[model samples]
Target: MTDRVLSGCRIIIVEDDYYQAHDCKQMLQQAGAKVVAVTAIVPDLPDLLAEGRIDAALIDINLGHSHTFDFARELQARSIPFAFLTGYDAGMLPDDLATNVCISKPADLHRVVSVIAGLASRGG
Candidate 1:
């Protein structure tokens, strides 16, 4: 196991896949993050954010049938840093969100944890 580099971060995960979400949750937990919320739907995001402090987010670009650009906008507006985990290329993302981090699906677990940790450490 690695060091607890993400010890103080609180994260929200918005992936629609059951296995992927659970796997990601385990990875973050192992990295010492408190996964405040994990859901396959987008509607819960606003409520989750309103419920408590969230240091960062790992979002899947597609939530089964819906897209995530609008939700990402809200996260951006709230100053909560997030990165997309998608199978698609960067060109597939909305233009406004083009600059945000885009980690490919089947993500590198270490990279995912490290990116979120970096965002929290930077106070983003």
Candidate 2:
């Protein structure tokens, strides 16, 4: 495992499901990415963004109480890139966002590493 590949990459995770968030964070941390924050709600997102530099994000399409598109827009406004991590199928995503890359739930650690590497390569 290369520790420096994702060095200094700040990743934000938004998932209402606590276990999933924990698991994802562990995977990301193991890959050498610094997880800035893991939040289950969007109201806290702006604050998190304000507090640090976010290079990329792993956002769940649906929080327990709401969807993440609005938060995605916020990230877009900041020119930060993000990928969706969802249990829901691609069909569940809005057409506009369906083109965005996503990792299905029960994501493989290696695949997650590869995806993050790809995102990093794109300067995400």
Candidate 3:
């Protein structure tokens, strides 16, 4: 990945684990993007989107007892690119969402950063 592939990009992080969220935020910022928010809860997605600029996102599949498929749908409809970072098998994702990318947990930070950078750079 380039040093500034994500420059000026605004990213949202939907992750339940505090440490993972924080680390992802730090890595993305280091890659030159602004992390708009790192949220565990999914309520008021519209309000969340309205709060600031968002170009892409990295989401965990499971949060508490709920899955983030609905949130993914919303982002899809808005033409915002996102990737699921989950420990679960990608087969668990719904067929409608099967086309979207899924990154397994215990991720390579370089790869994660590069993928998000590609998404933001290409308007994916």
Clashes within 3 Å, all models in order: 0, 0, 0
Candidate 1 local lDDT, 79-109, one digit each (tens): 8899998888989988899999899988888
Q: Estimate, for each residue in 56-102, the C-alpha lDDT of model 2 and write its tens digit.
A: 88898988788998877777667777889888887877776777788
Q: For model 2, what is the error of residue 23's alpha carbon versus the real structure, in angstroms, after optimal superposition?
A: 1.5
Model 1 root-mean-square deviation: 1.2
List the candidate 3 regions with Cα displacement exceeding 4 Å: none
The candidate that wins on TM-score is 1
Q: Give each model's whole-structure lDDT.
A: 0.87, 0.79, 0.86
Off by over 4 Å in 1: none
In model 2, what lDDT does residue 62 have? 87
Candidate 2 has what TM-score? 0.87
Q: Write the per-residue lDDT of candidate 3 for residues 27-51, one digit (tens) a residue.
A: 8998899888888977466886678
Q: Of the candidates numbered 1 and 2, which has the greater lDDT value?
A: 1
As for TM-score, the candidate ahead, 2 or 3, is 3
